[model samples]
Target: SELHEKVKLHYNNFKGDPKDVKEMKERIEIEDE
Candidate 1:
C-alpha cells in the first residue's frame, strides 16, 4: 500500500499540468504490462 500511496502523492503533486499527468498515466499502464 505504500507504493500506491506514493503514486497517489506523486500524482497529486503533479496535478497542475494535464499533459504530464496523462503521460504519467500512460507510462504507468505500460509498466503494468
Candidate 2:
C-alpha cells in the first residue's frame, strides 16, 4: 500500500494547501499510469 501511504503523507503536508494537493493529485495520477 505504498500509494496509500504516499497519499496520507501528502494529506498531512497539504492540510491547508489546496494548490499543493491538486498538484500532488496530478503527479500521483501520472505516476499511476
Candidate 3:
C-alpha cells in the first residue's frame, strides 16, 4: 500500500511540476542513448 500510494503521490507531483517532468524525461533519453 505504501508503494502504491507513493507512486500515486509522485504521479501527481510530476503533473504539478512540469520542469521536473521535463528534466526527468531528458535524463531518461540521455540514459537510453
Better of 1 and 3 by TM-score: 1
How do all the candidates rank in terms of TM-score, highest first?
1, 2, 3
Residues 1-33, candidate 1, lDDT per residue (tens digit)? 567667757877885679989988787666555
The reply for model 1, stretches above 4 Å from the true place, is 1-5
lDDT of 1 at 32: 55
lDDT of each: 0.73, 0.74, 0.61
lDDT of 3: 0.61
- Quote the positional error of residue 1 for candidate 3 in Å: 27
List where candidate 3 sits over 4 angstroms from the true fold: 1-14
lDDT string, candidate 2, 1-33, tens digits: 697678767766776668878887787777766
Q: Estimate each model's TM-score.
A: 0.57, 0.56, 0.52
Better of 1 and 2 by lDDT: 2
Best by TM-score, which number?
A: 1
- Write model 3 residue lDDT over 1-33, tens digit each, in one string: 565556545655676468877776666556545
Ten-residue region with minimum lDDT total, candidate 3: 3-12
